[model samples]
Target: MLLANLMAFMLFGFDKRRAVRGMARIRERTLLLWALAGGGGGAPGAFAARRLFRHKTRKRPFVRWLWLIAAAQALVLAGWAMI
Candidate 1:
């Protein structure tokens, strides 16, 4: 989980830099894959970085899916804890 979050953080940073430079961007699927794999825990940091860097926060699909991923992760954790 820690490793996944770290990767997500770096990926987001890279994507933001690319965006600012008008370079090729990271795929949304790749970002979400990292999040869904366990980096969902880092969703907050990703969001904060998005805001701080002014990147991707306004994309409806990205915003919606990130929240969806985080909510699903929360429910999964909650269920696991209950078990």
Candidate 2:
């Protein structure tokens, strides 16, 4: 999770010009996996990156929702694990 967050932060902090494009599908799916693997914050980090970088923010609704759902799932998983 911490690692995922770190990667997320890296993904966000980097400039879009340095970003890897033409891989929206792959990147989105990868982010989803990271979120599912206990990296909930990664989703939002990606979203914020997209907004800040203005890259692929409005490309695919499905991927966006997938990230949202992944974040939510991670929250639930964490909550459940806490108890």
RMSD in order of candidates: 1.9, 4.3
Name the top lDDT candidate.
1
lDDT of 2 at 41: 48
Q: Which tens-of-lDDT digit does each residue in 1-83 have in candidate 2?
A: 66765665455444355555533333555655543454344565555656676765655774667566765867777998999
Q: Which ten residues in a row have the lowest lDDT in candidate 2?
A: 17-26
RMSD, model 2, all Cα superposed?
4.3
lDDT of each: 0.77, 0.58
Worst 10 residues of 1 by lDDT: 38-47
- Colliding residue pairs in candidate 1: none
- Tens digits of per-residue lDDT, candidate 1, 1-83, equal 77667777778889999988999999999887776775336665566666677777789999899899888888888988899
Error of 1 at 42 (Å): 4.5
